[model samples]
Target: MSLTMAILMLVGMWLSVAAAMLWGVLRIVRRHSHHHRPPLVPAKPQPVRRPRRPAGVH
Candidate 1:
């Protein structure tokens, strides 16, 4: 094969590999984000507690 053709083929292979790696990274990021999403509504509120007085100290 000619030198120019060989160079082109090498560059094409490198580009394809880079594109595949980028695609895999994006997929992983998307899946991770999907699993970590926060709830849309707030959680239930807890009731307040009143302080207790010491025994025989009133």
Candidate 2:
């Protein structure tokens, strides 16, 4: 094979590998992603919890 053909084949192999990796990562990410994203909604506010005084002190 000519040097140019060898180089092109190597480049194509590398690009195909990168594309496959990207496809796998995208699949994983999409599988895990949810329609109901938790961070988008605001959490409920907690009521203030007052400390209780000791019966003897009071």
Candidate 3:
């Protein structure tokens, strides 16, 4: 109810909001930078071969 208490509460609320905004900005920047990275080349697939049966197997 006191003026000092009200001011403190307001400041705390402001700090919480500012911190949240900063965190969101940081996440956006990181995402943007990651998306801007060079595209990765796809790995070539090896040719498939049939498995050979053991010589002793009839």
Candidate 4:
């Protein structure tokens, strides 16, 4: 109920919130710092197959 106690409580709350925000920002920055590399050569293409019709239906 005293003014000093209320002020200290407010300051503590502010510091805790600020610390949490800073931690989250650092985590995000670290996560995105890595560069992902693609494969040097692309995969080989597959050949298409044609369906054969019945001997009498064609």
For all predictions, the C-alpha RMSD in Å is 2.9, 5.0, 7.1, 6.4
Error of 1 at 13 (Å): 0.2
Worst 10 residues of 3 by lDDT: 33-42
Instruction: Tell me the tens digit of each residue's lDDT in model 3 across 1-58.
Output: 9999999999999999999999999999988897777877779977889899999997
TM-score on alpha carbons, each prediction: 0.69, 0.60, 0.61, 0.58
Which residue segments of model 2 deviate by more than 4 Å? 39-58
> What lDDT does each candidate get?
0.92, 0.91, 0.93, 0.89
- lDDT, ranked from best to worst: 3, 1, 2, 4
lDDT of 1 by residue, 1-58 (tens): 9999999999999999999999999999998888777767758777898899999987
Could you tell which candidate, 3 or 4, scores higher by TM-score? 3
Candidate with top lDDT is: 3
Candidate 2 on 1-58: residue-level lDDT in tens? 9999999999999999999999999998898886556665558877899999989995
- lDDT by residue (tens digit), candidate 4, 16-35: 99999999999998888765
TM-score of 4: 0.58
TM-score, candidate 3, is 0.61
Q: Name the lDDT value of residue 55 in candidate 2.
A: 91
Residue 49, candidate 1: Cα error in Å is 4.9
Between prediction 1 and prediction 2, the one with superior TM-score is 1
Q: Which candidate is the best by TM-score?
A: 1
Those runs of model 1 whose alpha carbons end farther than 4 Å from true positions after fitting are: 40-46, 49-58
